[model samples]
Target: MIWLVTSICIQIICAVHVIRTGRNQIWMLFIFLFSLLGCFAYLMLEVMPAYWGNRHLRTARAQVAGKVDPERDVRRAQRDLELADTAANHIALGDAQAARGRYAEAEAAYRKGLALGPGNDWGTQVKLAQVLFERGSSREALTLLDGVPEVSRGSEWDRRGLLRARLLADLGRDAEARALFEDVMSRIAGEEARCHYAAFLIERDDRVRARQVLEEVEQRARRLDRTQRVAQADMYRWAGEKLAELRRASA
Candidate 1:
């Protein structure tokens, strides 16, 4: 019974994908009649080829690989750095170390990258600031942020602003932090910005607003595709747990 239900769900999702992507209507029929097998065929024949370079697919693949071998990226990055010691290689090592929560190592890697003159000076500086902040050097992080060239748009801009907001909050500049968080939430569409903003509100005892933000996360989470859901599983889990905690508090 469980297998049948799961197959039906996959068939429905494949049918929806076919319609959305304007694939031949035959795929809908194939998916419906053949169910899971047909869906797998459709994915391999159509979806995978078309979306091989898609960020979501790459992220999902990375997430799965990371789970299976948590230090895989770190190992690869270290090997590359040892072979070339290029700025890009150093930056990559820093990113891998940061992902693994080794902030001290990440900070050293980022500084070495910066010393070697990374291609994106502002971005590398921001990354260094992030690791420094994680290492509890909030004031040094703030200094690094202040030194970077101001970006007015794109994901990099959002990340810089968000980090600055968190730094401000930690430094007891609540008004500045709140304003930046609001600005970031207003400009971004993803659950990360919403979740971070919600967390900020919760920290300040603004449960009503936090609950509303978290409910929005839940709504958007339900609408995400499999790849997107996998990439954002951590944020979604945090939002769910926070919501449950708030509910318990109210009870």
Candidate 2:
């Protein structure tokens, strides 16, 4: 009896969804007449495609693929590079290497791309600088960033500035780093800059200001849609965890 009731309820729900979503009224008939099978058909035929296309699901699929074959992207990138010894191919391989934390290989690929005269010289330079910074060459990274075009703007510009700021902070140029941090954070809508700034403040024992910055991240997170939230879920979670730790310490 319970099974029958549940199946009927599911059929009714599916029928209603088909109607409300305008997903072919024929699905409603198929749903009601065929019971659970009809609901399954509706889900498979009507609902699943939309869900599969969701950004979170796409991200999950990529992550699963990465875990299943850790070096899949690197192999694919190398294959492309072998097929075409082009600047973009080198950069792509570098990106794949960087994603896998093979910083030395990534730096080599980025340099080759730059040597081949990449269409986006600044972009390749920034990637090389990032890999250099990751490999403990902050001064060299800073020099590369210093040569980026002055007209750069948007996300790439923000990334370049954030990296330079981090390099500066590591080099004990706190005042310069702070100024750059503030400038980059003001230009972007995301929490990455703010999170980095909060970390910098925490390092300096300015927990109060750090807490305020983290609280602001929390507030912004609350307003984000599901896709946006999922995209930066790690940073948002880190902000929340850091904020809790700060509160505990103050208490």
Candidate 3:
């Protein structure tokens, strides 16, 4: 009798969570049918994630990585640095720091790595530039990228091109900025690049083009697989809101 009552209470709790979260209301059917197991699954899959938020989610990823490899990213990086304080080791440390959202620490680590190589490590320069760009130091970012030779291929080139375009635009070099922005777009930069371009267009008073770009982004996001949408939720949400605002302004 106690078990029966407890199971019912759990089901009720899970159902309420599902409703309040505006989750697939159909999940309530699973809760109603599967009893305690359903409630447990729902709690693990839904309630726990929503409750933990982004910071905790990042922490959880670290924990999972630790379990998969006992010496996870930061720990392994530290171990490597202890054995030999090399540029590669510092780069690893910088990567770990950036992964944990410690941008300032990452910048310092990347700088230390660059100092060791004395301008020979294009990789280190790019990484330091990335952290600087992320922290809103665009001029510093540009200075760092200035030392690195331009790559002819791969995602690294795309990142550098996008950042250069953004920084140029921010500094009011409109002609150069627009050309690079179009280059990024022409290269089929993903949803993120599209979103950034839309924002840039809006800022430059090209609302019609901005609306078109954002509408394309909104459609792409709507077509994303469930798992991808979940992983890219923040970006998708922002783009959707932007599209809606543009639409309403036109109306």
Candidate 4:
């Protein structure tokens, strides 16, 4: 009985760890079926030695690295800057800098790309708005987003609209936020856009609509092109989990 309890505990821990790490669902199922024995087998076969060799493991000979490699970061930043011709490169660099929490650097990179004469560069404008929003300039970000003309409201623009709607909601302009969300949903037809819109609806206590939106997103994600399917998979998975949490809270 004691061994059985220990096995169950290990299985639970392994299941939670797999979920947290976003491992493949098939592997998760296998671990669930075999319990602790399966988890032990997985650890022995699947987990990379390099991952266990990290400095955090006192048993490992590797020493903890001091800090992030600044040289590599600088080189990557420079390479991104060099590639900033069209709007996409600027958007990519802005995303990278934003991920690194260098908001000012991201904004500057986006603005420089915008200034390079790509008329009606909606993506660049949107990225700038995002950076501004992150920097606590929501009003300015809204103003910048509002300037995006209708002609630029293509599939890629849906993300900008969603961001604008979210900011509006944050500022307590619920009516405007709903309007923008509805507008974007009407025009956009992708899993990513639907996932974001669903999140907004769920926040507004509209669970039925949110669930419908998420269902559509799931369907669309399954039909997306290879690259887009991978991207949309992550979005749908997150949206689905958040939707479940919201439902539980309401319950």
> Pick by lDDT: which candidate is best?
2
TM-score of each: 0.74, 0.73, 0.68, 0.54
Question: What is candidate 2's TM-score against the reference?
Answer: 0.73
TM-score of 4: 0.54
Q: The CA-based lDDT of model 2 is what?
A: 0.85
lDDT measured at residue 183 in model 1 versus the true structure, 0 to 100: 89
Q: Cα miss at 178, model 3 (Å)?
A: 1.9
Error of model 3, residue 2, in angstroms: 8.1
Clash pairs detected, candidate 3: none
Taking every candidate in turn, the Cα RMSD to the unseen true structure, in Å, is 9.6, 8.9, 9.7, 12.4
Candidate 1, residues 186-239: lDDT per residue as tens digits? Answer: 777687878888888998999988988888888878888878777777878899
Better of 1 and 4 by TM-score: 1
Q: Per-residue alpha-carbon lDDT of model 4 for 1-251, expressed as tens digits?
A: 99989888887887787678775445566577878767875565445464564333322212111121223444566786686565556666776677677899899878877887457877678778988988988899989988976546676667667788878977779899888887887776665557666777777889888877776665656676555554345676797687677567668
Q: Residue 96's C-alpha lDDT in candidate 1?
A: 95
Error of 3 at 20 (Å): 38
Judging by lDDT, tell me the better candidate of 3 and 4. Answer: 3
lDDT of 3 by residue, 49-126 (tens): 544666545544445334434435787799999999988899999999887778998998888887886567887777
lDDT of each: 0.84, 0.85, 0.78, 0.69
lDDT of 2 by residue, 72-189 (tens): 7898899999999998899999999999999999999999988897356887888899999999999999998888787558787787789989999989999999999989988876
Q: How high is the lDDT of residue 224 in model 2?
A: 84
Off by over 4 Å in 3: 1-72
